[model samples]
Target: MATLDESERYRILSDERRRLVLEILAERTTGIGLDDLAQAVTTRQTTGTDVGPGTVDRVRIALHHKHLPMLDESGVLSYESEVRQVEQPRVASERHA
Candidate 1:
């Protein structure tokens, strides 16, 4: 399991979109599909703003290339690249306790 330090945890939560990912994951009892997750994140990020087309794909790519890896490395989430699925790790919940 990935270890967590104060700096790392803070880093994981630092970005608004990344924080949104965590929030969405926490609500899901099952792993969330990448497309669904991207849609949810885009919805939150572009709620009152004029979002351009391909925003969801951009979010998906960013999550795949950056944010998800950060969360996985921080022990917060288990990201299955092959399936493009994400689930909150057990240690992540324990860390919150």
Candidate 2:
């Protein structure tokens, strides 16, 4: 796992979407699929708004192309890009501790 300096950690967590992703992952006991994660994020983000498939798709694409990779590289989470799965890394628990 890679080490993140304070500035890097702040940068990674600065985005509302990424913070939401971490929050969701913290509540899960197992890995979440990219599709499911996207839906969850979209639902949380758009609380009362009428959400469309396009909205979810846009979120999914951003997560896949940007956020997930950033989190994975920061050792904050484990992202299996090929399988489109996201899991909180074991090291993340220790880091938090």
Candidate 3:
């Protein structure tokens, strides 16, 4: 796997959704459910907008199709596709510590 430098980490973290995901992951000791993560993202994203099940669904889709994979590939998080669990990588957790 390729190493992510500071700039790349910043780029990956630039998206609000991705940043939220990382923040949520960082707070949890165990893997978080994807649905719970999506809800948390939706809660933050819907502050001044029309929020609905559709909004949650859209976030879920984006997380599954785009964000999660990118995070997994970047060594930021370990995404268990079958179980839909998101966990922080040891290196990432160490950095946070």
Candidate 4:
């Protein structure tokens, strides 16, 4: 596992989207499909607003190309790009515990 200093941890959690991703992952025991995760995030982001498919698509793309990979690299979560799955690592889970 990669060790994250305080600054690195703060940097990773600084983004609202990344924080949301971790929150969603915390509720699940298994990996989530990228599409499902993206939808969930979009729903949360635009709770009372009417979000279109395009908005969801944008969030999906961001997660796939940016957020997921960053979190994966930081050892905060396990993101399988090819399979498009996201799950919190045991270390991350334990931190929540």
Among the numbered candidates, top TM-score falls to: 2
**1 or 2, greater by TM-score:** 2
Poorest 10 consecutive residues by lDDT, candidate 2: 88-97
Q: What is each predicted model's overall lDDT from 0 to 1?
A: 0.85, 0.93, 0.86, 0.92
Residue lDDT tens for model 4, 34-68? 99999999999899999999999999999999999
Residue pairs in clash, model 3: none
Clashing pairs in 4: none
Candidate 3 lDDT over residue span 50-69, tens digit each = 77888899999899989999
Expressed as tens digits, the lDDT of each residue in 1-97 for candidate 1 is 5677888878777899899998998788888988899889999988898766588889999999998887887767888888998887866467689
TM-score of each: 0.83, 0.89, 0.82, 0.88
- CA lDDT, candidate 2, residue 71: 95
* Residue 79 displacement in candidate 2 (angstroms): 0.5
Candidate 2 segments whose C-alpha is farther than 4 A from its true place: 1-3, 92-97
Q: Which whole-number lDDT from 0 to 100 does residue 72 have in model 3? A: 93
